[model samples]
Target: MKAVVLVRTRIVYAATAFAELVLWQVPKPVVGCTHRFKYRLAYVVDGTCVLRYDNEAGKGDHRHYAGKERAYGFSDPDKLIADFQADIARWNHENRHP
Candidate 1:
């Protein structure tokens, strides 16, 4: 089968912060991933992408935050979304002004 889009949406959190999520089910796993799903979930602030999760071609499941990259344990689509949202909340909370 061909690639099928599962989710493609942009969530606005504030005037300058928003999230873009795109998920697709491909015929096969990406080059390095073990699952058939390919996804990119990102949270942008101002005009910069400050947080992101992706299973890129050569990189298996991974996430980037605070300018650092790390491996991510991806179990399912539901868990992926949940983890991303949780991180977004953490980021916002840690960066909140007094």
Candidate 2:
């Protein structure tokens, strides 16, 4: 077995959307998705989890939105960031937030 190594972290705060995020990348991505390492990305708005993408301990990679959860494919780190940004944009647009 290979030892898991910690890699990188990204953080973002979008005041307009009222969200905070933390993303961690490791040796292997969570198993649910076809990608090698779509480890995790999470966003909380006003203390509520508004968006999330992650591979749970054993559940696989998935996405959560406004309390609903679904399967998600994580391809690359950049793409993950882009996707998260886009989702935030959509939610803000729908809610008429800044």
Q: Whole-model lDDT for model 2 versus the true structure? A: 0.64
For model 1, residues 1-98, the per-residue Cα lDDT tens digits are: 99999999999999999999999999999988889999999999889998999999999999999999999999999999999999999999998911
lDDT of 1 at 9: 99
lDDT of 1 at 94: 92
User: Residue-wise lDDT of candidate 2 within 1-98, one digit each (tens)?
Assistant: 34342334544455523444445544554555454553556666666667887777667767898778987766666777788779888877886666
Candidate 2 ranges with C-alpha deviation above 4 Å = 1-25, 28-34
Deviation of model 2 at 44, angstroms? 1.7
Models, CA RMSD each: 1.4, 3.5
Instruction: Report, for every candidate in turn, its global Cα lDDT versus the true structure.
Output: 0.95, 0.64
